[model samples]
Target: MTKDIEQRLKNKDINPTAMRLLVLDFLMQQNAAISLTDLEKGMGPSDRITLYRTLKTFEEKGLVHHIDDGTGTTKYALCMEECDADHHHDLHVHFYCQQCKETFCLPNTQIPEITLPKKFRSEEMNLVIKGVCDQCNPD
Candidate 1:
C-alpha cells in the first residue's frame, strides 16, 4: 500500500503526506471505484472536510478521476495513463451494479466519442452502465 501511494505520488510529481498516503492506499485496495462516502467509511474516524480536501487535491493533481454514476453519488477511479499533476484520461466507462450499488471501472472498455453541436467544448465525459454485476447475477 505504501509502495502504491509512493508510486502514485511520484507519478503525479507531488510530495505525499500521511493523509495522502492513507487515501491512496484505501483507493488502491478497492476492486471497484468508490465514492466519498465509501472513503469516509473505510477511513473510520477521518474528518469529512479533510477527506474532501484531499480528494480535491488528488483530482487537481490528476491522480484520480471523478465518475458520476447518475445515482446521485460521485465516485472516483485512478487514472490509467501516467497523468501529470494537471492532466487526466477522461475517456473510460464506469459500471454500476444495481443490486450491490457498487461501481466498478471498466478498464479495458473505452467510451465512444459523441459529436456535439458546434462551439461546444468537451473537457470530460462520463459513461455509466447500470445493471446487476457478475457477483450479483451468479446465475
Candidate 2:
C-alpha cells in the first residue's frame, strides 16, 4: 500500500510524506469516493489540521479531485492522470445511492457538455446522479 502511494505521488511529482502517503493509501483502498470525515476516521486519530492541509496540497497537485454531491458533504477521489492539475476528469458522472449513501464513480458514463454564458470559463465540472446502488437495491 505504501509502495502504491509512493508511486502515485512520484508520478504526480509530489513528495510522499508519511501523512500524505497514509491518506493516499486509504483513498486507494476504497472502492468509491470518500468524505473528509470518513478519511479522518480511517486514519485513526490524526490531527485534523494536518489532514486538511494534506488534502489541500493533494488537491492543488491534482492528486485528488473533489466531488460535491449536494449532500452537504464533500467527497474526494484520486485523479486518473499524473499531470491532470489543469484538466480535471470530474466530467464523469457519480452515482450516489440513497439507501447506503455511498458514492460510486460511473467510469464508462461521460458527462454531457453544457454551454456556458458569454465570458464564463469552465475549469471543472461536477455531476452527481442519485439512486439506489446494487448492494442497496438487492434486485
Candidate 3:
C-alpha cells in the first residue's frame, strides 16, 4: 500500500515525503471529500499548515481537486488518473449530502460542455447538488 501511494505521488511528479505519503494514504481511504479542518482532525497531532501546504501542492500537481459545495469551506478529493499538472479531466458533478454533511464526487456524471460568449473565457467550473445521501436515506 505504501509503495502504491508512493507511486501515485511520483506519477504526479510530487515528492513522496513522509508527510505527503501519510496525507495521500489518508485521502485514499476516505469515502467522501474532506475539508482541511476535518483532515487536521483525522491526522491526529500533525501540523495544520503542513497539511494545508501538502493539499495545495497536490492540487497544483493535479493529484487532487478542491470543491466548493456552497458550504463556505473548500473540500478536497483525489482526481482521476487522467489528471495532470497541465490539465484536470475530472469535470464531473459533485453531490453534497445535507443530512450527513458529506460531499461526494459523482465521476460517472460528466459536466456538459458550455458554449460561452465570444469574448468570455472559462477558468474553472463546478456544479454541486445537495440532498440526502443513500446512507442517510436507506429506505
Best by TM-score: 3
Please give the distance, in angstroms, between residue 65's alpha carbon in candidate 2 and its true position after superposition. Answer: 0.5
How many clashing pairs does model 3 include? Answer: 0
Model 1, 1-139: lDDT tens per residue?
5886788687776678888899988887888888899999999999999999888888888888888899888888777766656567657788899999999888789898799999999877888999999999989
User: Weakest 10 consecutive residues, lDDT, candidate 1?
Assistant: 81-90
TM-score on alpha carbons, each prediction: 0.91, 0.90, 0.98
Once superposed on the true structure, which residue ranges of model 3 sit more than 4 Å away at CA? none
Q: Write model 3 residue lDDT over 38-82, tens digit each, in one string.
A: 999999999999999999999999999999999999999999999
Ranking by lDDT: 3, 1, 2
Ranking by TM-score: 3, 1, 2
Over the stretch 25-139, how does candidate 2's per-residue lDDT look in tens digits? 8888898889889988999999988988888788888888888888999888877673365656546888999989998888678998899999999876878899899888968
Clashes of each: 0, 0, 0
Residue-level lDDT for 76 in candidate 2: 86
- List the lowest-lDDT window of 10 residues for candidate 2: 82-91
lDDT of each: 0.84, 0.83, 0.97
